[model samples]
Target chain A: MREVAVVGVGMTLFGKHTETIRELGEEAVWAALQDAGMSPKDVQVAYAGNALGRISGQEMVSGQMVLREVGITGIPITRIEDACASASFAFRESWLAIASGLYDVAMAVGYEKMTGATTAQIMEALAGASDTELEADLGITFPGVFAMVARRHMYQYGTTREQIAYVSVKNHDNGALNPRSQYQKRFSIEEVLASRPIASPLNLLDCCPISDGCAAAVLVAKDLAPRYTRKPVWVAASGQASGFFEPGSDVTVLKPTIAASQSAYKQAGLGPEDIDLAEVHDCFTIAEVLHTEDLGFAPKGEGGPFIMDGNTAIGGRIPINTSGGLLSKGHPVGATGLAQIVEIVEQLRGQSGHRQVQGARAGLAMCLGGFMHSDAGVVAVHILKA
Target chain B: MPETESTENSRIINEKWFTETPQGKALAGSRCRKCGRTYFPRKRVCVQCFEDGRMEDVALSRMGRLYTFTVAEAGPPGFTLPYAFGYVDLPEGVRVFSPLGGDFARLEIGAEMEMAIGPIRQDDGVDVIGYIFKPV
Candidate 1:
């Protein structure tokens, strides 16, 4: 397989968007094209990732319509949906297209218009991310699921509420530094702990909000990258895996993340030690803790103390979620995956002003979608190097 | 059956996967005869052996140990807020998500729980019968 590199990445501010979903997709796509110093004509193929487009009263084939509005037409356009990992999977597909010598230039775009719907409507749509047949009917939501994991983590590892709250405090602090983040105001640990409880052991601050936004990235063959940009973040590996129905030893651990990260590490020929920073799927405070451990950054059951010890902060050993993660950046679902990749690209290029990890050479982006059985239904992990 | 009877009988949510017996109502799951693996809500074929196994209906164990749990102060539409729920690991080796019955603070991991079937909530003027795990 040939090598692939991300030439340009672009995204709207991670917050509520009043524009139509098509316009949101267009803006991000145009920004990515401009950043790559290319035009619509340059894109050989395209993939759009969207999860709840129907919630917007749009057609199922919404990707093509969204791209067509951006003057990007006549290409083999396809829509990709993996819940929150929609755009990340789209990025993986675009990367594969280039790496497989299919297309020299490709684009991946992910968008979600969540704010257009009512809060109850939005909640119902997000609930669809879980197994409706087995889970949602039981009044199970993401917060409920993550709360169970957090409770188990606390019970098994002696993790404290203060330790988990620290993840929110730290991420909000970083989010304050990011202009694109949703919640710019820094939050205190007390503030997070005192927030409205969504589920026991997890307050509203512990959860990522229902946001509306979009993200896009332009990828090209490694050889053709220099023509578009000098600072090309090479796609080292893309690993994706599905969860098993079989019950595992512990519900605290996300088995699919561990499985996917192992494949990513093996493909990249690198381990956690080699990673300078990462933008993991911190949909909840507990999620960050779990992903850090599953990604091999911290030892099993040590993720709580790892964040409390400032190991995941920007200046820490392996800075995770310098983009404020989904916690503060706001989780727009479909667009979150590409948004993480876009952050990694910015950090790799040394363009992220306040949240930049100093002298970062390589970074990892982990995105997960849906809950199946006892774990994430699907998880996609990508390792990128400068 | 008449249409009126059918509609009333459909009070049981996910009827095919649930059944009533003389002893008690239990969740209906499938056990693969080939590898003896049990799955909740039944399965058409055994995922373990990848061959057509004689899947038989097996009433899941009515009692299990609470694996993990949480009390949701907020819930989706039609669900009463401040509801407590969690995953229960049954002796059948399948973990099921069910509403927790009894006091919220009293819930703990490794606690014994028994299955209870009744109206989970009222939907469209009909009681939605569902499963839950109650502290023993």
Candidate 2:
């Protein structure tokens, strides 16, 4: 395969959206095309990632509808739905299209409208990602699912409630600097600990909010990169993996993440130590801790203390979730992975302003999708370099 | 007689999953004749050794240990809140996801549990008989 680079990236402020899903996609697509010094016509192929479009009343073939809204139709447009990692998969596919010489320029867009639906409606829609026949039948919500994982981690590694709370504190602090973050206010550890309980050991503060947003990226062949911009974030590696069904599998270890990260590191020829920063799928506070260990950023079971000591904060040794992650940036589900990519590209280009990691040359963005039975449905990892 | 009647009359969540045996009500799983590997909610073929895994129906161990649990303080509409949901590791080497009943405060990891079938929720005045794990 040939080399590919992310020429431009764009994302809307991750919060509630009053407009339709197609409108959201249009705005992000326009912004990305403009940033790339190209137009909608320049995009040869497109991929859209939307998880709950049907539940939002957006019918199937939503990709074609959204593309038509942007005045780009009749191209080979395919929709992807992989729970939370939907956009990451789209990005991977976009990278493949460009790397395989199939398309010189491709666009990947992820959008979701979560706030337009009622709380109960949104919960039920998200529940579709789980094993509806088994787990959801037990009335287990998302927080309930992660709480069990947290409980297991606590039982196995002596991880404390306060330790997990520290992750929220750190991410919220970073979110305070990020204008695009949903919650910009910083919360103290005491405040997080005292928040309303969603599940035992995990309060409302530990969970990412249901959000509505859109993110887009423009990928091009490596040789054509300089024509679009001065600095391009090269797509060094892309890896995706599926986990085994949860039954009889270990919960504490995110096996898909472990496998995907190994593949990404191998493809990139870089290890955890070489990463300057990272954007991880912190759907919950405990998730960040587990991912840190699974991605080889910390020793097995040492992720709890790693954050408690302020190691993951900005200016620390290998800062993580510098854009505040899904916890504060808000998890728009389908749009989350591409949003993480947008941040990494911005950080690498030194355009992140206050949230920037100084002199960052390489970054990793990881997204975990869906829960099947007990394990994750899918995981996608992307490594980017300047 | 009541248990057998409920299994026949009431709508159990995923009927193919649970079966009432002479011993008692247990998860209806399938064991591979070739590899001896077992799967809950019975599969048509073995995933591992694919040797025409024509699985034979077998009852899973009713007793198991609570691997982990959580008390959910919130839930979707039409569902009971503040319920106990968890994973139970049966002796058959398969873990099952179910809602737990009995003392929530006393629930501990690795605690012994046994299978129990009862009403999980009421839909339109009809009780939905479902599988659950209760403290042994």
lDDT (10s digit) by residue, model 1, range A163-277: 9999999899899999999999888999999999998889999999889888999999988999999889999999999886576457677889999999999999999999999
Docking class of 1: medium
Candidate 2 global TM-score: 0.97
Q: What does candidate 2's lDDT look like per residue over A38-60, in tens digits? A: 87888899999999886667759
In the range B2-61, model 2's lDDT, one tens digit per residue, is: 643444446666677778788777899998888888888888878788867478999999
Report clash pairs, candidate 2.
none
Model 1: per-residue Cα lDDT over B1-136, one tens digit each? 1211225633666778676666767889999888888888888888888657599889888999999999998877777778888899989788888888877777999999998776665576776777878988
lDDT of 2 at B18: 76
- CAPRI level of candidate 2: medium
Q: After superposition, how far is residue A172 of candidate 1 from its true place, in Å?
A: 0.6
Judge candidate 2 against the unseen true structure and give its global Cα lDDT, from 0 to 1: 0.88
Those runs of model 1 whose alpha carbons end farther than 4 Å from true positions after fitting are B1-10
